[model samples]
Target: MSTFKAPKGTYDLIPPVSETFLAVREALAAPLRRAGYGYVETPGFESVELFARGVGESTDIVTKEMYAFTTKGGDELALRPEGTASVLRAALEANLHKAGNLPVKLWYSGSYYRYERPQKGRYRHFSQVGAEAIGAEDPALDAELIILAVDAYKSLGLRTFRLLLNSLGDKECRPVYRAALQDFLRGLDLDDDTRRRIDINPLRVLDDKREAVQKQLTGAPMMRDHLCEACKTYHEQVRELLTAAGVEFEDDPKLVRGLDYYTRTTFEFVHDGLGSQSAVGGGGRYDGLSEMIGGPELPSVGWALGVDRTVLALEAEGVELHVPASTQVFTVALGEEARRTLFGVVTELRRAGVPTDFAFGGKGLKNAMKSANRSGARYAIVAGERDLAEGGVQLKDLQSGEQAPVALGEIVAELRRKLV
Candidate 1:
């Protein structure tokens, strides 16, 4: 046997299982489109500095996980480890924000690459469906983005996820909180890495998942207490709006998002059932990201839901998405003459908007019926020399084993009636 396998930390979404991923993409796109968000696509890789400046050099994503390299042309490029930075860059490059559309809303779905120690729900390559709102900053906009995420999950019948919300304060107030937090952190026993992070981003100290760190940092300063007057009012308004819209969330004072651009409103969608890797998706407002990436000043807010983790969430909750098994009728030709004649009939069916599949080569009627059964089609169009010569075909309901002889001209109508 050939010794080959899918790369470590990566997987192939194949066959019947891939239907779940398609379902997720569809479910996510429907809401965004309904909410007036247009679809956007960007390159898989960007200038290395795009992420270095946008995602923050101190963050693990850029510091370690980024798949960066110099191309043959000697240009530094990196496969995107996330979506927001690239999407925002595209918006800025295309000047979409200045096209008179305030808060240009866009949704995108694509695969991202990151190098990391593979673990459950964490991979070097992953797919995400993300949405971004650029060029506007409003408390209601924050709430709207969060609600869009929640609505997408609910529309897909996911029930085990919870939204954790917090505000990291804006540029005006975060520095003050950062200083206070640094003071508190310095008093505790911390490793060199943690200490260095304190200088670069003291807020991330609150993100420590270690039990020992959590124990000593309990009394540390919280961003909520240090938010400037405007941010305080904005946070409250966002919470109030969320509540008014019936979107539930828990206040998480320690929510320091893993990126540097996120400011003020930040949130994560966590699934209780997906142990360890419970974050199904998360994102927050980034008012400074545009400037950080050398683009025109553009305020934006967005989120990305992990398609892999989402499928796991559905499985954990015992929810099955009823993906369509067959697009249309599968025709089984019993004889050579029947095959030649039904070839035209199948073409007409397809021309009329009926998705149809037919067997090739020679197979007996019994084996052909077996193939039809395997097709997951609701109805199988069976034709033999006898039926073809009679100017008709036999329609068998695969689900019920019932058969009816119908005129060839009426096959499309007959199938549509049965399908509908």
Candidate 2:
């Protein structure tokens, strides 16, 4: 025998559990769809320069985690590490900014890749449901994205999550803070890699999770303290709007986010039950992202909800999603004549919007009945040579053990009425 297995970082989603994943994705996108967010689809991979320019040169996503490769055409491309950059690039390519709408809203759901050590809530490949509202920089737009994200989680019955909010000042005041922060970080004892980061992007030093770095960062200059008047008012208005919308959030000064393009308001929905990797979904305002990637200066706010992590959160909180079974009607036929007739009946039933399946391989009465019972179908259509000759079919209620005979022509209507 040959030894074969799935890739180390990926798992095939199969059966009853896969239904739950689909349900979760739909639930997360429902509110966005209701709020005029049109669906947007993007390729799994994009130009390496798109991420390198948009995500930031010093961030782990581009510098270390991205899955970059040179194609046969000598093009440098990579499997998208996140959603916002690609979404912005797509909107730019399509020239959605020229459509005259202030904010072109869009929703997307797909897989994202990152070369991280696989753990409980982190994986090399994971699914995400994301939404973006571009071409607007108003605080209300920021609040709208946050509200939609909150509604998505609540719609999924996720209660044990908290929203962490912050503001990374935009062009007006960020330079001053960056300079002061760089001066502070330079005095500390850091390794060569971190020291190099201090020059490329000093804000990343704030996101470092190492206990040693965090210990020295206790006195680091905070963005909230140095926010310019416009940024301060923008962050305050976002807070006020979120509160008016009845969305509770905690002010987290350390929440600088992991991206370079993020400016003004930033937030994250974290589930404490997930231990170290707690973020279930998060996004913020990217006021300069479009121009950073060579597009016009279009601002956007969005978030990507982690399907795998959200499922883990549900399990952690003992929540089970209500997903319907695959088959609603199971057909059992004996003999060649009955098989031919019932096959047509099954096809008609499916065409009428009934989820129906049939027993194949000519199984006998006892075995076919067992298979029908195991299918989780509400009713079983049982027919044999005797019933076929009589122009009738036996519709058996699998749960009640009751049987009734109906005219062959009336079977589809009967099942549809009962199933409905």
Candidate 3:
């Protein structure tokens, strides 16, 4: 092993297992693609202020978990701890919303960084597939995103996960709820740090998971109770739409999420089997985020499904993803001349859209066949000097142990036929 390892809270995605992660990401993004959401990519790091202001400075993600640093140029930068803020910043900077589109739909898949005490289902470096609908505030837009997420999870055969939903009243009524929540939180026996959170963002204090904190928060005011008539109607419409579409969700009164940007509709996808870190993915509306980062007012809604956590959820439910074999056909060449000829054949097979691999380093037939077996390929082509002289190559079906021969020029066509 090399003397170095992936940084303490990070991981390497190796084969077999890595294939599952890829499948999970593709599954999550498929619905977004079909929904007219274009792909978006952002830098791994951005100005620290973008997050401090957009993600809410009082949130743990900004103050404690953010991987922030001051560059040699005296510029402060931080590896993104989440996707929403960075994505919105990019959309605003590029003026995508001004392109005559009411909601610029975009989807993204990448790794996000955070500084946290890593544990099962929680890591400093993790993968996520996110979607954002910028410049819209309709409840149907929120319902649409939720439906798309549910479809993605269902497409992966995940059934035990639950969608927990809540509405964190928008600017009109959030202030009223915030004050009420802060008043209730202050009466609890909280630490100095948590007490300070009461002043900055008391909703975050309600997200506290500590047993001592939980015990004291029994009577805390819920956002549902404080929602204004507009927010209440909007929340009800979202719920009604989700139900009409057959997406079942439990109404969570205190689902504030970890970020401070979330306003109005907040939700989380949780798998009961995931233990303490049950949230596989979640996101919600951030109506004021655009203005928070010095952009025009653009109400947006989005969700990011955790690729790592989704894989864990799959395993927890004992669901097997149908990851296709990387190599569909393996070629074993005997002699140097046979290697050259078979190498050309391999290239031809690949050009013909066959997933083919060749045995390199000139191993003996036995070792080469062993490699072919381990490749998970359905078929193997073996060519020796004698076989090449005869103008044919031996073809073996790895699954049934059937062997035959096909003309050298016809091998690619033969494999393609059998594969189909």
Candidate 4:
């Protein structure tokens, strides 16, 4: 046996399974593209401070899960644990916000790293499909992002996931709400770590999944009740837009997302059937993220859906993503003379936009046809020494089990006319 593997907490995506991943990415990004979001690609790793500031130092992403290391140049860098921060950093560095576009719309598909205890849907390394609309504070943008996500899921035939919505309130009201939350948290019997969370980011305490912490938090102060007038209006407008658009959502006061930068609007998508790791994806408005990362004050909203988790959710609901079959034609040749001649014809067929494949081994005609059948090819092109000598070949329709002898010079046009 080989002494190497894909490393713990990480899995290889191969073949048919990879097709599912591609399908999910396409389903999610298709709507974003239509909505004016151009594709963006950022490096897999960035300076550690980018996330520390953009994602919030107090959050588990930075404090615990991030895979950070000092490079040979003494620069601290981390593989992105999430997509939004790096995308935001790229936007900031490129002066995308200053490009006069009110919202620099972009979509990305990539992998993320986190030192998590490996589980069904959670991994030390995972893939994500995220979208960001930067430089905007409009409630419609918030609602639009959410609607895009919902549409993406629906288009993928997913039905088991539920949308969770919340507002953390803007800067004007969040401080007051944090103070109230702190007062309540301090009174609870919490561990040292929980207490530290109170000082660094009291809102994160609301994200505690422990039974005891959740019980103690049942009567805690709610941020929604303390929202400032402006935040309340913004949140309300977001809700109104979603409602008017007929997007279903549940208002969750406890959805104070784990990230520290999220302000005003926070949301999560959960699959009820996924057991403990039910959150398939989520994101929110991070109005202070730019300033936190030492950039100008630019508000941004976005979401990252777990491609793995989404695939699991689809599986849980028995939703099969229909990945189209690999190609239309398979070419089979017998003897060296025929093989050489057919190889050129195969190349020409492919160049002419035909999805074609050819047998590699010098197999007998029967075995070649068998290979063609296994390849899911709709048609098979067979050429033997005799056919090569006669200036023609045979075309067989695998579906109809019918064959026709055609002139060699006319095969390409015949295939094109029949296949198209």
Candidate 5:
């Protein structure tokens, strides 16, 4: 038995399944790319302070799941638990906001690490395709982000996910709501941790999944009641735009995201079939995130969809993505001379963008044909000593069991035409 194993809470992607995951990621990123979102890549880890400040200290991601450590140089760093903070940090460091583009749009896809107990839909190492639009705070931008997310899911043939949205009330009214919420929380019968959160960040209390905490929050002040005039107008515009765009969303006043940076607008994509781990993806307007991390004030909004959880959701709905076969053309050479000629043919076909595979060893014809069948190839090219002497190669359509001879010189072009 092999001694090594994948680390706990992680799995490998191989073959046909990996193909589907790649397709899902591509489908998710397509709309963003077309909508002017340039791609950005960041390191897997960053200074511990970046997330601790950008994501809220009161959030579970910072307090419980962050994989932080001290390096030999005594520098504290952490594997990124989320994408928005790292993406924003990169933008700030590069001074993207000063580029005169009202909203510097970008999209990214990579692995994110957390130290949580692994579940069916959750893992320590996971993949996310995320997008961010920074610098501008327009209702149209929010609607665009939401609409793009919808398009991605629809493109994947997903049908059961719902969007829950709310406005967290910007700086204008959040303080008033915060004080009122703190006053209300102090009077509740709660533990010290719950009480301490009131002092640090009262909004996070609304996100508590604990039954007891949720019960205590039953009478908590809803964010909608505290929306200031400007925030109310902003929220109304987002709603109007979504309606006009024919995108549907449910208003959840208690929907405080798991981050403190969210303000003005917050939303989550939930799949009903995924049981308790219902969220497939979510994000909100982080108007204060730039200033929180010591960068200039830059309002941004984005969302991160979990590739793994999304796959699970697809399974829950019994949907299989239409991933094309990896091997489009399989070659089986019947003799030594045929092997050389067929290998050249395989190389030529592959160079022409055909997914081609060829039998290497001089195996028996029966075994070689079996391998070709297992390759999931639609067509197979077979050549023999006689066939080569005749200046032709046999093209067999594996799908229909049809065989025809094509002149050796025109084989690549003929196969290209058939494959395309």
Candidate 6:
């Protein structure tokens, strides 16, 4: 082992495990693609003020968790702690909302960075597959995002996860509820940080998970009670649409996600199996976020499913994803001439859309065959000087231990036929 390692609270996705991560990402993005969401990519870092203004100054993600730094050029930047703020900034900068679409749907997959004490389901650096529908305030858009998340999880064969839904109410009614919640929080015994949060973002105080804080919040005010007529109707429509689509969700009155931008409809996906970090992924409406970040009013609803947590959920429930073998065929060349010839064969097979690998480093027949066997390849192509002299190669079925001779020209076609 080298003296160096991945930075504390970070990890490298390598080998067989990395394959599962890719599969999980694909599963999460599939629903978005089917729903007309186009792919989008953004830089790993952005202006620190972008997140400070968009993610909110009072949130822990901004106040403590964000990995912020100043560059040599005197630019303040931070590795993105979340997806929505960065994505929205990119969309607005590129004028995507002006492209004659009511809701500019986009899907993205990438890593996010934060400074945090790492845990099983939580990491300082993690991967997420997120979808956003910008410039739309419709309930169907909110419901559509939730349903898409549900479909993605189910697609990965996850059954035990539950969707916790809530409506934080819009600007018209949130202040009234905020004042009520703040008053209730003031009467409770709490730490300085918790007390300060009551004033800055009182709703987040209700989200506190500490046993002491949670006990004091027993009868705290709920957003559902303070929602105005418009918000109530909108929330009801979202719930009704979800129910109509056969998606079951529990009404979580306190599901104020750990973000300040969310408004009206809010939700979280949780798996009880992930103790202490039960939330797998979640997001909600952020209607005023655009204005907060110096852009026009573009109400948006989105969710990011954590790839790391989803993989953990799968392991907890023992749901193994179906990842096909990476190498379908492994080739073993016996001699120098055989090496050049078989290398050509490997290239040909790969160009023909066959997953092929060649035994390198000039290993002898026995060692090369061992490498081929370890490759998990279904078939092994063995060619020696004698076999080449016969203008053919030996194709051995790795599974059945059967060998047959095939003409050099027909090898690609024969393998494709066998694979099919």
State which candidate has the highest lDDT: 6
- Residue-by-residue lDDT tens digits, candidate 4, 134-175: 988899999999999999999999987889999998878888
lDDT of 2 at 332: 94
**Candidate 3 local accuracy as lDDT?**
0.93
lDDT of each: 0.90, 0.92, 0.93, 0.91, 0.92, 0.94
TM-score each candidate.
0.98, 0.97, 0.99, 0.97, 0.98, 0.99
Stretches off by above 4 angstroms in model 3 are none
Per-prediction backbone clash count: 0, 0, 0, 0, 0, 0
Question: lDDT tens digits, residues 305-412, model 2?
Answer: 999999999999999998887899999998889999999999999999999999988899899989988888999999999998899999999999999999999999
Candidate 3 structure quality by residue, lDDT tens digits, 68-147: 99999999999999899889989988899999878999999999999999999999999999999999999999999999
The runs of at least 3 residues in candidate 6 whose Cα sits more than 4 Å from the true structure, single-residue gaps closed, are none
- Cα RMSD (Å) per model? 1.2, 1.4, 0.8, 1.4, 1.2, 0.7
lDDT of 2 at 187: 99
TM-score of 1: 0.98
TM accuracy, model 6: 0.99
The Cα error of candidate 6 at residue 286, in Å, is: 0.7
Give residue 409's error in model 5 in angstroms. 0.9
The 10-residue segment of model 5 with minimum total lDDT is 359-368
lDDT of 6 at 368: 88
Candidate 1: tens digits of C-alpha lDDT, residues 304-351? 999999998999999999898754688989878889988888898889
Compose the digit string of candidate 6's lDDT tens values, residues 1-420.
798999988999998999999999999999999999999999999999999999989999999999999999999999999999999999999999998877999999999999999988788999999999999989999999999999999999999999999999988999999999888889999999988898899989888888888887888889999999999999999999999999999999998989999999999999999998999999999999999999999999999999999999999999999999999999999999999999999999999999999999999889989998999999999999999999999999999999999999999999999999
